[model samples]
Target: MIAITEGPINTQAVIDAVQADGAGAINVFIGTVRNQTQAKPVIQLDFEAYDSMAVKKMQEIANQAAERWPIQKVAIVHRKGTLQIGEAAVVIAVSTPHRKASFEACEYIIDTLKQVVPIWKKEKFEDGDVWVAAHP
Candidate 1:
């Protein structure tokens, strides 16, 4: 599953969606807005996306993870628009019959998503803001 939401993400919902009877482990990775970057004091962030491309890219990451690992499920949820420091920006969950597969697939999805997704992040600082490569 994939989505671009304005409100905060539900972590429990993500875990529940990926769990299965045969799965022995579920790995979850959460990305948060940091307080600082490049030595600048960050106050918040504004995330923007080409919604159509973002969703397609997210699904592609999930499909790639599934094919590369022996996993039962994959879920990726990313938030858009304005977000404050410490807010959850993205969540990736993967469940498999073993711990290793779950871990590997979860990491793969996040790595690939960062590289390929069309999400742009504007880092808001006390003095000024700048747009940089996001989710990578």
Candidate 2:
């Protein structure tokens, strides 16, 4: 499953999507909105994405991880629109026969998604807002 939604991300659903009978390990990574950036208090965050391209890039990242590891299944769900502090912005889950592969693949998917996915994040500070990198 690869999706770009404007609502809250269901982290458990992402994990469940990757469950496999032969897989012994499932790794999940959740990216959350923080209350501050560089000591500046943040009121909220607004995320925007070229939805179709974002989903395509995410799927490509998943496929690449599958090539590098013995990944049984993978799910990546990212939320756009406004989000408050502590809300999950993204959830990535991967399952593999072994723990190491699951860990590696999960990490790879998130790292690559940040680099390649066409998602923009705007940090809404108390005084102003500034656009930042997707996962910065």
Candidate 3:
């Protein structure tokens, strides 16, 4: 499952969607908005995305993870629009029969998503705002 939402991500829902009977472990990654960046105070963040392309890219990442690891299910949910500090912007859940694969795949999904997904983040600072790169 993959989605780009305008509201806050539902962590519980994402976890429930990726849970399975055969899965022994589920690794979840939550990306939250930070209060500061580059030594500047950030008030909030505005996320924008090419919705259709972002979801497609997320699914591709999930498929790649499934192929490389023994994963049972994957759910990636990313939030758009304005988000305050500490608010969850993205949630990724991956389930597998063992802990290692679940952990690895979950990390892979988030890293790959940031690299490939067509989602842009604008950092709102007290002085000005700028569109920041999705990945460092």
Q: Sorted on lDDT, highest at the top, how do the candidates line up?
A: 3, 2, 1
Question: What C-alpha lDDT, on a 0 to 100 scale, does residue 86 get in candidate 2?
Answer: 99
**Each model's C-alpha lDDT?**
0.90, 0.93, 0.95
- Model 2 lDDT at residue 7: 85
lDDT of 2: 0.93
Give a tens-digit lDDT track for model 1, residues 59-126: 98898888889889888999999999899999989999999999899888888888889999999988
Residues 1-136, candidate 2: write the lDDT tens digits. 9999988988888889999999999999999999998898999999999999999999899999999999999999999999999999999999999999999999988888998899999999868899996665
Greater lDDT among 2 and 3 belongs to 3
Candidate rank order under TM-score: 3, 2, 1
Clash count (model 3, backbone only): 0
True-structure Cα RMSD, model 3: 0.8
